[model samples]
Target: MNKLAWVLVSISFVVGSSAHAQKEIPKAEGYDQCPLGYINTLGTKCVSPIYYEVEPTYGEACESGWMNIGAGYCKKKTILGIF
Candidate 1:
């Protein structure tokens, strides 16, 4: 019957759309990278001469790690989705 066909069509539409619905990757809930030479610390950016000091602040989700942006500092939340 037309009613059955309509129900089937609706179900198919829902299932088809679900397949295309991509899930977003998880992201760190904190600041990434640093303010150039400055390193992120205690949820704040700071200046550091050594590279190691800045790596941890970016978290491990980054593709490689936070890079020295420009001016103050910045970090991309979803770099490459390694996780």
Candidate 2:
């Protein structure tokens, strides 16, 4: 009987401690504890992207690429294959 009661209590506590149960307590007035650490660029709270390096060769320009056909990317006319 005691073992069953203890098991039930533990299960309830585990379920109640889920992420959904987390409520951000406002620190000042219009802000909370930042959810975890920082606010994302999209104004959401959680893990965000970490910049490691730049793009690969035939890199970023303004628009064009092998995929986009023509705009401003690689900037090479032969590479553009428009001739």
Q: Report every candidate's CA lDDT.
A: 0.41, 0.33
The model with the greatest lDDT is 1
Residue-wise C-alpha lDDT for candidate 1, range 1-83, written one tens digit per residue? 99999999988965764553222211224545444445445453454553322223343242344443443233433224221
Runs in model 2 lying further than 4 Å from the true structure: 19-44, 48-83
TM of each candidate vs. truth: 0.30, 0.25
Number of the predicted model whose TM-score against the real structure is largest: 1
Candidate 2 residue-wise lDDT at 59:
33
Q: In candidate 1, list every pair of residues with a backbone clash.
A: 35-72, 35-73, 38-46, 38-47, 39-46
